[model samples]
Target: MNIKLSVVDQSPVHGSHAKIEAPRLTVELAQLCDSLGYHRFWVAEHHDSVHFANPCPEIMVASIASVTERIRVGSGGVMLSHYSPLKVAECFKMMATLHPDRIDLGVGRAPGGTGLTSHALAFPHEPHHGDLYAHQAQMLEGFVNGTLPADSPYSTIKVLPDSSPKPQLWMLGSSGGSAGLAGHLGYNLALARFIDPDNCNPAIFDSYAEAWKKAGHTGEPNRMLAIACICAETEEEAKLRAGTAVYRKLAAQMGQREDFLTPEQVQDRYKAMSTSEQAFYDHILKGYTVGTPDQCWQEIESLAYQFYCDEVSTVTVTHSHHDRMDSYRLLAKHL
Candidate 1:
């Protein structure tokens, strides 16, 4: 089937050396994906999280964009709730000015961290009182596109280095809650299926398209689906590599934060989990698209068709950097 393949890297902390290795590995993977003909390479933002390393995706986008020649580089999502919309617009606009047509500003509503980190981010300023995410998103879009209403408070202030080919704006969501809002704002939607695999709803895409048309958008409303995928030449090897991610996800669900373990170590820990924990682990395991190349492709194809999306972005994490790279390489080769 015809589809555009992309990548969303969380720069997952895999082994003991992740503190120094993970971020660098992201650039390396971007180079690989670019050469492999992947469409875009997006980095994620996190805060005070042991599982992910990079907290500032804007910087990573700059770094990745400088090194890769072809692949689009962007923030898989910036946690918009933590910063001023104007600041975000400035950062991404600067990146776009440097690398026109190659940067994407995908923003999400989540805090990207714990309650404590959220407080840290909002320190000195009282936490926002209401549902201001949508409002912030609107302001962000306005600032980037230079289209804020004339009556708006910030309309007189211009985003400097104004230039053509602004970074593509996207609303990243794990659920359908923001689909319509994204469309109404004329922004693309990127559904993060990896975050909540079982919650897939076709109505989300329908609502987005319907809203886009209602909003008088001229072209097709662009959308993408991001999936947690791990592919290998053999299914057994793929499942073995996925063991670490399964254990880590379940551990986080249970409120425990720890570094990734080996597949063998993960198996030992799995054997000790209680019945409920094991069931939860099983559910987590099922959420991932794990198998040989053809098997992974089949599931991805079906999911894209179901969601009415033509672009598929994969997020792969494994204990070994080579394994992680191989997973993406194999999937790209399959296509």
Candidate 2:
């Protein structure tokens, strides 16, 4: 197993930290990840959430790429439905131009939000036409390969000043549909184990690999899994910290403002949960690797070996930025 590691700085804006400071922290973390031999650093896109500050992934990737030397930088996903395929290709191509070999384009099928927020970000035209993701993916491939039609209006136009050496494309998914699609298309797959906890069985990865073979793709498909990771010096300390982080995530999932509570507050909240609620919390947290350094390494190794994942992306969400940074440090050392 290669045991490559990546970071998805989701830009979770804590209640205490100034919203403006989130980007800086993210950049700093990216640089640190690069220096520590991380394979990639991805930023996620979100809007209308006090918890997350990143609304534009391309700009953020560019900024982080400018400061890092070796690490690949890209979006955890571009949330494809929100923009034109051509525009998405152009933006990432521009990023590839600047960073050259250090750029990736991970696309997601979902709109990434719901209700008025989704409406606010909706594309001008029907975003999801028949097989929209597949069509867009094909179009994007054409743009990257410079093989689109030459004379016809839409097909003929090419992304200008394209500096990309053909950006690596990956499909981001929380379910099997994305896995099958990515495999069929011969693109990389980024599985979010932390998102769809109920559906995160190792069999999903087996299905992906089998589908890749069935798709007749000559090369092995690149498979990645993102997991919540919290590592500390002691098992108790790690679990405590991870529990606190999980509490914050649950609060956010329940549409509450995240990061407003202190560690003590998190503990109190966790204590107030009923048995079923605690079971749910424990299940979600099970998707995470949290313990002492040895235990964390064991769990991560088990996950990678079992899933046959090419890389593991760790999203460290601790109350303290220092603790988050420390967790990454420990992970890098072990990974």
* Count of backbone clashes, every candidate in sequence: 0, 0
Give lDDT tens digits, candidate 2, residues 1-335: 76888887787665456768887888988989999999999988887766567889999998999999999999898887677778888888887876788888998876666555666666444435225777777677677667666663676675875433667888888867777777776778898877775687778777778778998979777788888888898888888778766886677677676454666776788789999878877877887889888898788888888887768888887666677788888877765
TM-score of each: 0.97, 0.91
Candidate 1 lDDT for residue 64: 94
Clash pairs of candidate 1? none
Worst 10 residues of 1 by lDDT: 122-131
Global lDDT scores for all candidate models: 0.89, 0.78
Please provide, for model 1 over 38-154, each residue's C-alpha lDDT reduced to its tens digit, 9 standing for 90 to 100: 999999999988778899999999999999898889998999888899999999999999998899999998888887787788898766632699999999999999899999989
